[model samples]
Target chain A: MPRWFYQLASPRWCYQITGKLLPGFAIAALLLIAVGTVWGLAFAPPDYQQGNSFRIIYLHVPTAYMAQSIYMTMAIAGAVGLIWKMKMADMVLKCCAPIGAWLAVLALATGAIWGKPTWGSWWVWDARLTSMLILLFLYLGVIALNSAIESESTAAQATAVLVLVGLVNIPIIKYSVDWWNTLHQPATFKVTEKPAMPVEMWMPLLLMVIGFYAFFAVALMLRLRNEILRRERRAGWVRELLQQQRG
Target chain B: MNNKATNACHLPELKSGEISFQPGRIFWATLVRELNLALRRRSDLINPLVFFLMVATLFPLGVSPEPSVLSTLAPGVVWVAALLATLLSLDSLFRSDFDDGSLEQMLLSPQPLFVVVLGKVLAHWLLTGLPLTLMAPLLAVMLFLPAEGMWGLMLSLLLGTPTLSLIGAIGAALTVGLRKGGVLLSLLVLPLYIPVLIFGTAAVEAAVTGLPLGGFLALLGALLAAGLALSPLAIAAGLRISVSG
Candidate 1:
């Protein structure tokens, strides 16, 4: 294994690395998100179709994308942990669940909030929205299963299997839903098939997506550092770190 | 992970620690064992079907009883009820074996765990999925589903329910080790269930509208084929996880 990859296997090493990286990510996330929100909300030209309501996509699209991306990350992390017996990978898997779930919620809430103004209904079984709801359920299931299991290793492995299974279904769910939508013709608007968009509208959306990814990194590192501290509290390095902190 | 590196240092010997048995015979034996178990406990066979019936019954009472209304909703109501019923039966898929310690034995078997897992899943589908497929038409009738749609309902369930059984076995394998696994099982399985439900209901709706129903059924069939090939491996992986822990 390469030096960096090998180093990542150590919880203490991981904790230290994340500690160093967290601040950089945190600052970047804050600046970018603030810029993106202000730019998208205030400056971007309103859609010719939906007018002002379309601005919510800056929040909705990125969070929705992150919601799916984070779950995929958890699955990959889990496979690495299960296959390589990498302890830190399990930490990644466990720490990301609640963050991913809430991202799904934020995406759903923002989508619904946006929907009321755009679609004249708070919720519609639009394919994308319905799939997001199911994603939330999948995240909650992993969380619920983890909490239900008594042994930490057992929980990790079980949730790993589940995350993997859910990963496989994501594509199937997406395709089936697209097919169903075409069959049912339930569209209030076909926003999915957007033609060429002006760069001004898309630029802030790009910033928000990047910002969300950075924020996810910061959030994951924070939770994982806490997990490492609690799980490895009995280790000599943790004790040494605490003493160093006290000094 | 390498099986050798599972840190599974404790290799409990099976009653008959033989791996030389033919795969077909081993599969047959496992299937027969599960069948016998399901037969002995009649409720395992009946309860889910009963639940399917009752849930389907509630929609009519809960919603409008107009035949036109019921007919339009029949495809969805019946499919959802069938989906939930299969989920109800999935909780016990690996529980009995785990509790009796046979799951550990199966894991350590010279026979590939995938084959044994597939046999058990096959038995599961036969006991639950097959019966539900048969029972669906009755529910369709009760829901006032158009006669034209009856064949679609039956065929879709026939093809689709086994996919549910296969996909759900992964959830069952993962959760079989937990104490309160019932609700969690549904939570884990239902998202995966969406595609199957969508196509199954779509097939029936297509039939109701006199559209070409073959396309939706073909999709459902494709799903079943994929489920059969891949899901046992996932179920095997899940069983290994629970067993290792």
Candidate 2:
């Protein structure tokens, strides 16, 4: 392993690095999201068919993407924690669950808002939407499992195992859900599956996606920093750091 | 002393510094022990079957009981009921062993934990899922499911519930150390159960509509194969974590 890889196992080092990286991510997230929201809502040309109601995609797409990506990241971090006994990885996994769950919720809520105008309902049994809902449940399961256990490390390890199981099921769930939806109702329109879009539309979408990722990094680092302090409160460096902060 | 020496000379030679490990023996022992224990608790054996029947009955009573309406809902209703029944029985998969400390002994034994876990899960399927599959045909008839769909329901349940048992074992093992795990176990396992539920119902629907049911059954089989290949490892890992904690 590389030197930094080994260093990551040390909670003190992880806390220090997250502290260093937080400001950069926060700034980038703030600037990009502000710009992306303004541009997507006002400046971006309306869809030829659905008009301005499509602006919700700016929020929905990014959050939906982040929801799934954060899950994958959590599962990977879980695997790393389980395999290598990395406390930092466990912390990362723990912090990712709520953020991911909220993002899944945001994605679903935004999709509903967008759906009312386009699909003419607050909710539809659309494949992507249904799978997104399942993803949210998966996140809730992880959170519930983690909270149910009293011992922190045991909770982390057990939820890691569950996360991995969820990881393996995700693709299977997605495929089966798609099959089920098609069997019941053939989709007439695919909102996100437009073959081509002019640059004016996609650019903001790209910016929003990047901003969401940066925002996730900011959120994760913030939570992970607190988690490190909480888990390592009895360590000597944590005591020194607290004293330093107090002074 | 002379007679003892003659008897020892007649005995088979044993290898020194070599440990004997028989996974087959451990697997059978765990399976038989789990089966015997489950059979001894008649309510544990029968309650899920009753729940399966009651839940299946609920749809007809709760919804319109007309044959057309019941037939339309039958596939999903039967599959969902079976799924819940399996989940209901999963809490006991590791609870008794964990409570009595044999779980720790199983972990410490010379046998591979994977085989041991698989044996327990197989035993779980036989006790809970197998009974649910057998009773499903009655529920199908009660729900007004078509005659053609009966085979599909039975076949799908037969193939799908084992996978459900396998996956549910992971949740059960993970939560075995907790005091209140029943509701949490459902929350954890149900999402994973969705795919099987989807495919299983789809197969029944196809059969009802006279479409070929090969593809959905194939998918269910694939899931069972994947579960067999992978879930034992997860169950074993969860068991270890729970036991150690």
Candidate 3:
């Protein structure tokens, strides 16, 4: 077990390490997502029923998955910060908010676009759509709460509590389709049960999922680096790094 | 043996008799004091009521003068108006005390803070929430809800609005110190208020359609009980952070 993961709790060490890793992750993310998009858009077979409109699912599903997972990630980071008083965990939670909100927006936009073609309306008051709208509001609430406060730590703690409370909505959003006679369709992808799609559709989706994760990792590292530098601006290593950049 | 008997004889004196009042009496006293403060602030008492009435009256102009259309939209319109009215009342629940020094004084008081917060919340429910419940029957008529659903509407409001107060207290406590807190307060609390809104409207809708009100009212009552038990603790914790920071 390399010590860098634990050592990164210190702002100076995290700043130094992520500075090295950011470029690599960025390049890798760009390459992978590009390949995934080309493969998904050009090569993947159109659905026998929905045709080209089904292509939106490639972006919609992955971002929706990321939106939900990132919230859980933020909440877990918040729990860690609350329990162990870890500065890195708090930093991660803060950095996660805007990224999560943007991802939520992407999910909602893609969802609405998908709805227009499939359901003949831009929006519907179905369970899945309603719950996802609520999720977007929860993200906005956390981000708004975090920014409105003057003190960093107070903002962090307050937003953390809000995030935990808002977690109540997550399971509801997931099961809304099942619990109600929603206009939206039931989930097609399940881990335990066999997938509904043939290998062609699922493979592109799988690649896109991996690409989304890589993109998230790259974005998180960049944001975390910026946060660490801002918090550690007075440190000697930061001063040296600044001098090096200036040179 | 004689010393033991002497100690036993002194046991009642050793246990302080001054702190033995019933908890219920203390709660009542706190609630009374909160109510008195609320009444002394006349604007707080009247403003939310006026806002509620204004909102209910606006619907006819915004929609149509036709009774059928108004009656059809009445249940949702009234419940949404009430939710907004409750939200307006909620903004002041902690903001004023927080702005002045009163919240600090209460926090420093030897009384348990949860009891104190709960007392304020109850006073809020009585002064603002109770009035809404009383006025609901009149508004229900204006919105053209069936005459029979009036009682059911009142019953549902009675059970439902306290939960609104409790949940709103949590939001108000969280944002008490922030500048321009009103919009954020709505954003934070509205999602939590969904179950109440859903069941409340359903109760009215059921009554209008001549269906049974038992299930919806039961759900509303359960939600209120849960809010009463849980929200105070969250509000208290939020209060400490808001004040300390």
Q: What ranking emerges by TM-score with the best candidate at the front?
A: 2, 1, 3
Among these predictions, the greatest TM-score belongs to: 2
**Index of the highest-lDDT prediction:** 2
DockQ-based CAPRI category assigned to the predicted complex of candidate 2: medium
lDDT, candidate 3, equals 0.82
Model 2: lDDT to the true structure: 0.88
Each candidate structure's TM-score, on Cα atoms with residue i matched to residue i, is: 0.92, 0.93, 0.89
Error of 2 at A244 (Å): 2.4
Tens-digit lDDT string for candidate 3 (A214-244): 7898899989988888988898988998999
Candidate 2 collision pairs = none
Q: What is the C-alpha lDDT of each candidate?
A: 0.86, 0.88, 0.82
Cα lDDT tens digits, model 1, A18-132, are: 9899999999999999999999999999999889998998998888889989999999999998899888988899999999999999999998898898778899886777888
Error of 3 at B174 (Å): 1.3
**By descending DockQ, how would the candidates be arranged?**
2, 1, 3
Clashing pairs in 1: none
Of the candidates shown, which would achieve the greatest DockQ relative to the real structure?
Answer: 2
